[model samples]
Target: MEAAWVNILMLILILALIWVWKKFNSLWLTPKRLEKILREQGLRGSPYRFKVGDTKETLKMQMQAMSKPMNLFSNDIGPRVSPYDHYIVNKHGKNSFIWNGQKPRVTLTDPELIKDVFNKIYDFGKPNMGPNIRSLIPGLAMHEGEKWSMHRKIINPAFNLEK
Candidate 1:
């Protein structure tokens, strides 16, 4: 009986390890695969740096430029979007690809493609916000469904009109 449980546990662990390996290795952190995709698309930028990629470089650059944030931009209106835009712009020359650690983003310079893509954006489905882990909050909400809704509604007033 004890040996049976041990065999089951070992099988579960093996399956879990395989799942994790496939998830992270094949899906997101494939340097060679991404390189091939970019090369095929004729995308120009720095080569990917394994898992860390551009995240380290971007963060380091962000800290260095944080002191003199004013000097990070070229045009007057460009800096208004976000602080990271300045970091991106400083590197990409207005139209270039940026590696955001996990993925490479290409800023399109061609006006025609931009307008066309914006017009025909319906093909893409809404993004998955991923998984929802159960919380330790003790209430009707902890139970399920309509109970959760009622609890959420009751809690909403407490948060909104707090004195």
Candidate 2:
């Protein structure tokens, strides 16, 4: 009876340790490693802030931008619609990065770079947003591989100049 009790306790302790290690790796180690890689690649942006990342700053900027009224005649809506992005681009140049929670999003302002990325779609993977955001923005933009290619084929006709 004493030996059985000891074995059960040992198993439970091992399981608990495994769980804790997984949480630590997911929440801290992974993000820190990604951040270092991005910085080494010459990308600059806000440092990762635990699990929240840049959510607080992004929300504040968006709220502040939306609070002000826009000029009806002005064609510049980028600042109003995406204040956080505008602020980041201005502060960090054309090719910079921003943290979307644990994920680092790289901003490509150069037309050629954007074209190259789009051309080699399989080389890059899409960022994983929260469930709420995913629900709001679904379809071709979120798809990958065959699904993306199929969606693009189905929608390509609408953009043709001769159509």
Clashes of each: 0, 0
The Cα local distance difference test for each model comes to 0.60, 0.85
* Candidate 1 wrongly placed segments (more than 4 Å): 2-6, 26-32, 69-95, 124-163
**Inter-residue clash pairs, candidate 1:** none
Off by over 4 Å in 2: 127-163
lDDT of 2 by residue, 1-163 (tens): 9999999999999999999999989888999999999889888888888988888989999999989999999999999999998998999888888888887788987765765676577787676788899889888768778888888778766545477
TM-score of each candidate structure, all chains considered together:
0.52, 0.77
Number of the top-ranking candidate, with lDDT as the measure: 2
Q: Candidate 2: how large is its RMSD?
A: 4.5
